[model samples]
Target: MTDTTPADELRTAAQTLLDLADDTAEDMATNDYWRSAVVEPKHWFHNGIDNAVGGPAGKLAGLMSPRFARMLAIYFRDEAGRGQDFDTRAVTLARVMNGGQP
Candidate 1:
């Protein structure tokens, strides 16, 4: 058998979600909140997928992975409901990617 770590699982799940999003919806524009949301561990798979398609910082690939694009939509929903702060959101993502508080 093969070994599948939580990170790998997360990546796969993330990729799937992003693909679904691209298939069903429109692309997400980069904004302060989106920038913040993109960094969380929960969203890290999107982060990687985004990078694979050229993230916000690089080029505008236009949801190269639909699943990741959709996962981003869900995050936006939560962010909207909670009225999350851009800085706070960004920090969460930072923590997820950097392995500690940002």
Candidate 2:
């Protein structure tokens, strides 16, 4: 039996996009493309409005170089958030997903 909780599954899902950047040279979400190349479409946010915005942003983020992705991941994992500018949610999320790994 699996000991994973719902939160664990969500973190795992979030890690999916982040992990696509790993071991990659240029692209991040390679699996999102290949896995759904001919079947279901790949999407981060559904709904016409949200998809309109997040769709492009997600695609752009996914195109980030592996180095950039790694650095961002590292930043989110280690650096604490300043003022109300960057919230700690992402930081905490990254820390959770990375499990304190750098």
Candidate 3:
């Protein structure tokens, strides 16, 4: 059995979500309906995140992981294009969570 800390679990969960977002973005990029319906209305993703997460920062916090939450907060607060491509944002967050420069 391998022992993993809570932080480790959080990081793994975050990475999984980020990868999903990246895949969704990749698919959306090629779909005209998504482009017009989602991309065009900049707030669509933001609203969805906010709603799904239960607040602007709720999603990360709701993860029940402090370290991951902090990383996400910092990313959302300081990163550019918060309302743009989700794949890019997810990748950026994943990099930071992994201790890489985003």
Candidate 4:
């Protein structure tokens, strides 16, 4: 029997979402609806799926792995959760991003 943890499951699910998004990737240049929507990102955000980061973005690749997801969530969820400030949180997040290699 294989042992798969919840993080592993979430990772798989994230991958599936990325794959599905790729499968249905539409060229914004040729997509009038999408093009018009992005023209006023904040306005469209009030409608649905506010996934934009800076302005108009998609496919959250940073959540590619469970570890990455956890690290990011920790930093964003609450800096006070661990009694760490912004700099500390940034350091912690950076360490995880480096994969603890060195």
Candidate 5:
């Protein structure tokens, strides 16, 4: 039996999705996947960062010192890794919220 509440699980899963997006952006930057004749990696990376952490999360992440933010980005990127699909997670989360098993 799990002691965790539904709200707790939902919050954890949302954070995981955000972290996954952040990590994917970092990977794109690190692996030079954003480099191409038509695209600049720096612009692509920052755009991703903005999209990933936008709104309230963006405000909080922006409040961190430059070094701390960079470190945290790297940490999240490494810890979360890649290949997870946020779209699928969204669907699952929706199901769970509706009292259905994902």
Candidate 6:
């Protein structure tokens, strides 16, 4: 079977897109147009909230742009918090569905 772990799968996907950008343009992500189009949409918070608190920013971070990475950094200040929030929600939902209310 595939030797990829879940984490590695994500990395591979990200890197694949990044490499595509690299091939398509010498500076694809660095371009303002690409940044505004791709990086701005997918920056979601714990509750599907936009960090900028408005319309879609784009999918730049997901596209593997460095600039998008930096912007993501600013928008999502606490990575651990986000992960914890997701985990908390998942466990809570599981417990609720299993009738293990607490």
Top-lDDT candidate index: 5
List the candidates' TM-scores in order: 0.28, 0.29, 0.39, 0.29, 0.37, 0.27
lDDT for model 1, please. 0.46
Which ranges of candidate 2 are over 4 A from the true structure?
1-18, 26-63, 80-89, 92-102
**lDDT scores of the candidates, listed in order:** 0.46, 0.46, 0.49, 0.39, 0.50, 0.37
The residue pairs in collision within model 3 are none
Name the candidate, 3 or 4, with the larger lDDT value: 3
- Higher-TM-score candidate among 2 and 3? 3
Best TM-score goes to which candidate?
3
Model 2, C-alpha of 95: deviation from truth (Å): 10
lDDT of candidate 3 vs native?
0.49
- Rank candidates, TM-score, best first: 3, 5, 2, 4, 1, 6
| Backbone clash count for every predicted candidate, in the order shown | 11, 0, 0, 0, 0, 10
> Per-residue lDDT for 1-102 in model 4, tens only?
997433433344344445444443333324444444344633332222334433343234323333444444444434323332334434444444434321
Measured by TM-score, how close is model 4 to the native structure? Answer: 0.29
TM-score of 5: 0.37
Candidate 6 Cα errors over 4 Å, as ranges? 27-102
> Relative to the unseen true structure, what is the Cα RMSD of model 2?
11.1
Task: Looking at model 3, report the run of 10 residues with the lowest lDDT sum.
Answer: 77-86
lDDT of 2 by residue, 6-48 (tens): 3443345345536756644323244342333333333321222
Candidate 3: segments with Cα more than 4 A from true spot: 37-39, 44-102
Q: Give per-residue lDDT, candidate 1, residue 66.
A: 58
- Rate residue 14 of model 2 by lDDT: 46
Model 3, range 5-101, lDDT digits (tens) per residue? Answer: 3344335646555565666556545654443343445444444444557864866543433334445644544333333433454555556665666
